[model samples]
Target: MFVTDNFHSLKQKILFFILLSPLLLSAQAFRSYSNEFLTIGVDAAGLGMSKSVVATTNDVNSIYWNPAGLVGIEDYQGSLMHASYFAGIANYNHASFAMPIDKESAVGVSIIRFGVDDILNTTELIDSDGNIDYNRIQLFSSVDYAFNFAYARNLIFKDVKFGVNAKIVRRIIGDFASSYGFGFDAGIQFERNSWKFGLMARDITTTFNSWAINEDEFNKIKDAIPGENQDLPETTEITKPKLQLGVAKSWRIGRMFNLLSEANANMRFTKTNDIFSSDVVSIDPAMGFQLDYDELVFLRAGVGNFQYITEFDNSKSLSMQPNFGVGFKYNGIKIDYALTNIGSVGNALYSNIFSITIDYSFFRP
Candidate 1:
């Protein structure tokens, strides 16, 4: 009876969180800050499916998407993914390994890095000639990194699983400034036959970043541009919790064909200027479809990031982005590729991602 009561209490908490999330936001101005890299999906498979894998994720990549899905792994697994973001101007990489501790529990660790390389710092002090001396320029880069440790376990209630991720985040801009933060995520998954449901709460404790700046170095480059106001360093940045909910269904079409479809909703409780308007809340909906041929090869497609805009004159517009990918499995190795659409920003941009996964069981001995 105690276990039953706790289960009901958890359910109530989850419902309350979902219902009250939007109301929790205040009518504050939108701002952007560090750890934005966390918004990027890491795996090729999930990116190809427009990140609608919250319910369908069942592999090592689950370390980033939905930790509860880690309970679906049959054994030990490792995966690596790389993407050429923004036409090779930036790089995004992810790696993870997961091992089952018991029949009902698992643990995983993962790392993610996203950054640009060898950017020429044009703000260096001018040379004697004052011809915008190229020799004074130095090479620097901006990078973001996150380390995640996750754990998942099935509950006494059949088909229900819970997971959590504790992560450390660091962001750097050459030697001028850096920020460090710690955050946590929690997730729940439920599976019944071919149907799955998932919910993830990110940054449940409101991630906080403490920034340290090299004021001397920054002052040297301040006002490098004519008539430009210098930027003052920030001491701290805070990110509020976000929520994702998803549902998936699978069907066997015949002896050699199988199909899966999933839908996901992403909600941000924080105010962000990047959205349509100065709304205190934001929501993005995504959908994906996958077809598996004998469980050997898979074709996938998805659409997401539908933003609705309202003009001052009461005009409305909508923007939709789509992504596609394919996957092949041989023996214990699986390879996946995805082409993600970046909308019509600056002459049609797209990202190419490649990922590989190896699955092996340590219990064979």
Candidate 2:
């Protein structure tokens, strides 16, 4: 849903047809939650939240965000993210690990958890007692393991890397609801000189095979609609994929400074299916600066199509219209963090990401 460039008059027409071809096929939009509240980028600790810059494999976390980045992983790398939000009522945590399996192969795993506290459980429709029981909370967890099986002697004298992953997801909702699903993701990454480009396609095949509902709640709803078929409205199965494209460039500005710029676009490719509904192809443009001292530090800022979800809002002030983050590097290890404000859907959004990276150098053959 964006515009790029054209080589010639005939090239423009050909490019238009190839890009719009996906609309001819079926589509599914929301692969995750309706809000897609999983933050805009990678771990909050890294500058990725402000930009889509995973093509170069700067760290281990990129494997989960873009498997193609795994081709750049050297030796072993790992990272962890922990964040608090909504006045400390919610928490997000994650850890990712990637290791070189061989000269041209690498594998990685990631675990992420989201928790909401002090959720008042109610029996009747409305709150009868002013003080509801605050004895429990809600929890959501997902674990993804990806193996980067990459091999490329050279493509026309250029290095090319391809990767794919199999992911499993699980969620629990305060004993009231729970669902688990299996999905797959694939990507290609390339890095040459100061330029990096990557493409990632997710949810090629996904199935939320099981959903458990509370027995008492199911009976209540069934009784409310006496003569009707009363099948649960949330039991529909979905199978669709989301494709994203990203590119980045980093320039050595001076002896003690570096400037990096990146751009990304995400879209839902179906035109006729309800699953392909809510198409909002958003582009995130970001700029980052690295202060090269004895210890490396990074500063970044950017903006995108993030507005509001259902839990929190910030429409008053700057309105979550911009994204910002910082990073720190020691030796070969790095850490990143980011924050965004979305105040439209009654929810506030926040994420904290941390990652560690190890570097290995290979002389040009």
Candidate 3:
């Protein structure tokens, strides 16, 4: 009787977990509608500086962060970055190339890919002999990719620049579902002496994701999992617009050291029915500092994504993410490394990123 009772308790727990899984998944899906992989900072330098690059970027990697900074690139530049995220469970990769079209204009192209590999597919249904079948299990992967083409030009004013990015996005889940999206971004920057300011409008026209699902394939797998049979959606997901504003100041310390500080605010506006919340607006702020030695070594640190949570009607708490990085430069090549702390969303996770860049200038006779 005790054994039978224990079995019943175990079954109850299993059923409860199965029932709760969908709710958790639904929340994640809703968040991803507008907060996809592209929003994640790419290069190690940007991530290392806690994504405070809006006003301090001046390389090919700026194609992903703030395109207006492309005007600061005086030569042809190329960058590549790779991140081992979530303790090897996933990978993020980015590459970009930028070149000057004239004294007043520059153009760049970049690509990003984030994905997980070799995820096992399992079913709850038992085999004929009442034993689990391991040999018949399948494996799959999920991936997200984005391609961006960007252009930047100095306005009639020498210290002001304007830029735009046109991008295509794709998401795929094994062989069951896929989504395609297109979006554009615009930005402006103003610089004078050691001070710089920037403004970026993300998804200025709003981004729309159209999903194409293989219902038959999904249903087959769903039938094997208890309480998992649900119809797939045949609709579109739209992402609203957001604005980013930033300012930075730089100072030369002595003859061999330089100090730079930056602050940024991201403002998100959404309707009552949007995925974020009923609140019409929200703001997230970040700040960082960089110390450079003789233009060869750099140290960076920052904090961002402050959140306030209330529990039990009496408990209130705050959370913040911290990041740090180091880099080295020689000749025209630069290498950077960064570590980012991601709070306990899915296990206590941290991301490590590495990136390299090369620059070359053509001399005009």
Candidate 4:
């Protein structure tokens, strides 16, 4: 009798695995977009310009862009942002804090979360009595989280700054599986003759994630489906290194108006849909501009994600993403809003992003 019961339990588990095969394949396989949540970016101000602020970024958001910019913090700064994607089905949130340790060094920490909550679990829909039961259905969530620790210092060379970031990545799949990953990033910024140049290397050491699967939970839904392989899924994921180079300059339009312009090139070793694609490396270029009046009110615009879209008839066309934003600052508090559109031409979704930043120079400690 024990042997017979064990066989039945095994059958159920197989059926469950078959249902979630698509998810398993995407998560376990090596891909260009591994740890893609990190690439989505943070802060309304940055996103408003389509993430083209790497050369000019110098606030709490710099923890994710180019940490070297953190040295721009005078005393202490904190930032928070929230946005919804995919028609409110998924949520992205971020928070960060930065402070200067002395006159030339600074430290910062940031957190990010992207998740899809309250998903239905139907593994237990069928009871042992051979009856269909809706009561057995459960709800669960799949979430990804990242923690960043950063440090920046002024290089001995004049007008140069250097920085690095240590990152911890965590992913959870409704208690059935989880992964932990570690990675590092390095960046440098140099200013000469009113021109700011920056370089950032993400996942410089090649980030890796090791997954742990719950055996007991995995076994609960045995071969509920026939003619399906029940082998355990892959246990490892890898994210290769990427490079970003940027240049920016700022000019005073008048006594009360200032304008800043920036351009960036993102390089990936693997061939991709970017405008410039090659087997050795692919480069995506972006540009943005910001106009501020009396350092209080601001307007921002940017274009990026240049790609060649292939049509049904095998023809290709160029496509790009556009972003817009506005900002207001008063009494050390700044509020920013951005309307960002993603996807190829004729098939795009818009998401609204909001962020707030506070700076306090009163506390020296």
Candidate 5:
């Protein structure tokens, strides 16, 4: 039988810590959002569930979702994903690899990039000779990249695992400016009976980005307008820590079906449109479920990003983002697809995501 008493006690402790998070972080909370590209997420499975897989992720994608789950990797695995946003105006890509080092330890690495390519640079449309020159126009790209290194180890306690990540961030906007940043993340996962719990702390030490602007390039735009782009931009950016808590449960039906459901609370110490917001913190909660037949064919759904919108009439309305997905897995190869709405219901911006993963241990000597 399951030990309900122990479960309750642990639950209470987790709740207490969650409640105290705001007080401990509010003093250092930042007013602006930084490194937003990292928040877009990787892998179709997680996005299909509105990124509610913190406690259940077990594949190479765990390196991005919750590193603690990397302990679930039993074989060398590789994953890749590609998606386009804003009607194909931007591209997002991710690649990752994970392997078990021993019975109790695992390691992973991941790379992500988001870019908008072939952007027309019209600043030099009119040459110094005061003549319109289409040939002077150039095409450039704005891109953001992140490299993650993760490690996980099982604890002495039966089913508990912990992990940490060191990440390097890079951003480039043509030749005008660039930035480099570093950050860390930590996560923990544990299970009791059929219940799973996970906690992920991102940017635990506050990510810092330092920028460099090329003065020669800056001079071109500095004179584009009389009073605009005159002063140098800010050179430093800071990203405050954020927390995510997750709970999951599983059930078996008949002989060929199984169901897994999860809920997550994403917390940031800032006032925003999230469902639960205060001056000290804001909480955005999400729920998702997956159903599979014989562990092969799967279906998933989720709803999240709950926000209160103020209308032009000074009235408020509730809005949320919804997502759906399907998957098939066989012989260690998995393919997943998700149809997600990236914006509010009223805006209705939709995107299609596809991801694939494979176990490559068979290729090893």
Candidate 6:
């Protein structure tokens, strides 16, 4: 009983700081490398495929995963993925390619884009029957882009590798505003025979400062409004700083069968502008598995904690446990699928994310 009480108390203290840190940091505001959305933070290739790091093969997406995964690879690889977010209301797409310039060096290019679609613009905030509100009016639709360039090399030490990513990012919110920022990612991987250990630091300097739009800047909007005093949105920019650590391993159990296990944790920090008063953090831990029934079929199942997190005790449940997926491969073609949910406290259908991604790659000498 005493232990339970102390645990609960500690949880409250952490939650209070997280909710208050945003105000504390700026006394004021922040999103991560890609956006506030973690679903699209890393490339879609890994999202619909597997979060397994230790056993993952060399691929262009490694720029966001664990770049050290490229250590033993000697190939030119690329993959394209499309995730239909929120039942096709929004589209998430990614493309990436990597080339081994030589045995000791590799370079890669990666891009992630999300299109927000079909938003209706109107004066009413809700749907109207006789005089009821419909929904909020959206003045414009926008898409976000995060471009990545990476370089990885085998370290002088045995079975160790390192890499870095330079990110180019931007976000357009309606026609009224947009923001720009840049960030970097670093990673290291260690491998000894079949088992590997990996770690990644994402969005080290990721931040977006909203641009001030004066009358002289946006002439079109100024001309239309004439003398109307239009109030702009918040003055502080929203930033998401990535702080994540993950470890994964695989055991080649038997011929035609492999059993793999993975565990990962990520905490996103939301800091206030120029205040440096600490920040908001969300910590998530996940455990999962992969099974290879044959050379042509693969299956995966994972469960993680978004609810029982230490600092997120009072938070809403964005992801429920038990996320399961499957995949198939033939020749050089591959297909994959996974299911994830984003439900508010009691709403079951709030967010149903079904993703399907394909990959076509052949070993290159």
* lDDT for model 1: 0.78
lDDT of 5 at 197: 96
- lDDT, each prediction: 0.78, 0.51, 0.76, 0.86, 0.83, 0.55
Top candidate by lDDT: 4
Shift in Å, residue 163, candidate 4: 0.5
Per-structure clash totals for the candidates = 0, 20, 0, 13, 0, 11
The residue-by-residue lDDT of candidate 3 on 104-193, one tens digit each, is 889999999888888665433235445556686678777778999999999998799999999898877776667788899998999999
Q: Residue 77 of model 5: what lDDT?
A: 97
Ranking by TM-score: 4, 5, 3, 1, 6, 2
> What digit string (tens of lDDT, one per residue) describes model 1 on residues 208-230?
77767777665554433334425
- In Å, residue 99's CA in model 3 sits off its true spot by 1.4
Please list the residue runs of candidate 4 whose C-alpha ends up more than 4 Å from where it truly belongs after superposition.
1-23, 219-229, 342-346, 362-365
How do the residues 1-365 of candidate 6 rate in per-residue lDDT, one tens digit apiece? 56644544454344333322332233114433235443443432244333545335456668667666654445666666666656677777777777786787788888888767654433233233323344444445556778888888988998778888787766554543455657777888777776666777776665555543333323323222234423333445545556556666778767888877777665656432211223566565666677877657777777653452223566532434455667676655556566544311222332223333233336322
Kindly provide the TM-score of model 2 when superposed on the true structure, using C-alpha atoms: 0.67
Q: List the residue pairs that clash in candidate 3.
A: none
TM per candidate: 0.84, 0.67, 0.84, 0.91, 0.89, 0.69
Once fitted onto the true fold, the runs of candidate 1 whose alpha carbons sit more than 4 angstroms away are 1-34, 128-133, 224-231, 271-280, 309-314, 342-348, 362-365
Select the stronger candidate by lDDT from 4 and 5. 4
Give the Cα RMSD of candidate 3.
4.9
Quick one: best TM-score, which candidate?
A: 4
lDDT of 2 by residue, 1-365 (tens): 01111122233234223322221121123334321333334465334444455454445666556776665666666666666655556665666777777767677777666666554332332223333233422333222222222221213436677777776656555444555566677887777888878787776664333445566544433433236425543433355566767777877765777776767665455542221234444332333333333348877676554432333563332222456777777666666656654221224554444444444332223
